[model samples]
Target: MLKVVVTGPLAVGKTTFVSTVSEIKSRHTEERMTQAGALVDQLDGYRADGEAAKTHTTVGTDFGRLTLDERMVLYLFGSPGQQRFRVLWDDLVRGALGVLVLVDTSRLEAAFEVMDMVEAADVPYAVGVNRFPTSPVHSLGSVRAALDLSPGTPLISVDARDRDECLDALIAMTRHVLAPLESV
Candidate 1:
């Protein structure tokens, strides 16, 4: 099975994305948010009511599986988004075929660190702009420019709540990562 890592900033919907696409029950290491914890966590734009909008956060990794065909199955590992959990990134990405870095347009800046970690891991990656209802609708070109993505990098819009959309994004990343080997 091919491994893929799903990473992004806090509350960017990594858990939801995995759950929506997984054929089986996905494993999550989520914990309920506390008032004290919310003060330290970045809760802006997640909800109008702040911490109330986000009741749970991923304390560890999220895991899911999707079988593409008889020959191909993807094992998805979702790394926790908070900076404190950055140490887990190396292990999560060690053997990953590719990575799907979900981004919240409302907080584009938060994505830089995640992207850096992915790049440091030296894995092929695609950027998926997870559009929340309150998120601004930026053009793909503009986002690419903002993220400083290479021309060949795959950048697509994705709805974390939608299974088909998430699947398509995964396919795009897989295709991009595998393209070179296919040529040989």
Candidate 2:
């Protein structure tokens, strides 16, 4: 089985993506949001269902498993997106085969630090643009330019709430991970 890390900035849909694609019962370490966290957690203009804002925050990690075919399986690990949880990223990303970094077009800058950590770990990664109702509709080129991603990196539009869209992003990451081996 390949271990794939699902990561991004706060409220970028890492948890939702994992839950949508995972075949097994997903495990989440989510905590109810309190007013005290409002200072650090930004929910403004971010809607979980296009109607209501998210009420919980991931405190530890979210886990799920997906079987792509008879021979391939993916163990998905979703890291907490808050900045305070960054210390755990190294451990979460350790030994990961690849990473799926979700981004909110409305808050593209929030992704830089997460991408930096993933790059520093030297793991192959793809970016998933999760467009919420309030998010600006930027072209893939614009998103790539804004994120400063390389030409070869996979960047795709993904609706984290949709299974098919999430699976497509995962498949893209899998192909990306296998490309180097295909040449060798």
Candidate 3:
């Protein structure tokens, strides 16, 4: 079994992405946003990404399961997007196979922190761009350049609401994980 961590900034669709692709019943720990909490959690970054205001947010974590085949099963854990909830990251990242960091083009800078965390954890990862209807289109090269991604890292475009799209990203992630082993 492989454990894949789905992480990204607030409102980057981490919860939605996990929900769309998980084969088993998904468990999400979301809480309705209160005005007091909103004051502490700034929306500047997400709004910059052209996301509509979010009413609820994932406070703890989201859990789901995916079976690639009879021999391979992936347990998906989506960490809370908010920085305040990073207390759970240590627990969430244990024995993770890899990470899928979702990025919104409108706020490219927002991905740096998550990428850094993944790197610090020394985990292999793939980047998935969660495409929204209003998201600006950019060439793969430009997007990779903007994110400072290496040639080997997988960067796939997907719609969080679309199951096929999410599945395609998962396929890309699997290939990324296997490429080095296959070469050796």
Index of the highest-lDDT prediction: 2
Error of 3 at 164 (Å): 1.1
Q: Write down the worst ten-residue block by lDDT for model 2.
A: 42-51
The Cα local distance difference test for each model comes to 0.89, 0.92, 0.86
Residue-wise C-alpha lDDT for candidate 2, range 100-149, written one tens digit per residue? 99999889999999999989999999999997877889999999999999
Per-residue lDDT of candidate 1, residues 1-184 (tens digit)? 9999999999888999999999999999999888888667887648622334888889889999999899989999988988878778788889899999999888899999888888888899999999888788899999999999999999999999899999999999999999999999
- Per residue, candidate 3 scores C-alpha lDDT tens digits across 1-184 of 9999999988888999889888987999999889888776766645423555678889988999988789989999998877889889988999998889998887788889888888898888899998876668887789899989999999998888899998888888878988889988
Q: What TM-score does candidate 1 get on C-alpha atoms?
A: 0.94
TM-score of each: 0.94, 0.95, 0.92
Show model 3 residue runs off by greater than 4 Å. Answer: 45-52
- Rank candidates by TM-score, best first: 2, 1, 3
lDDT of 1: 0.89
What shift in Å separates residue 12 of candidate 2 from its native position after superposition?
0.9
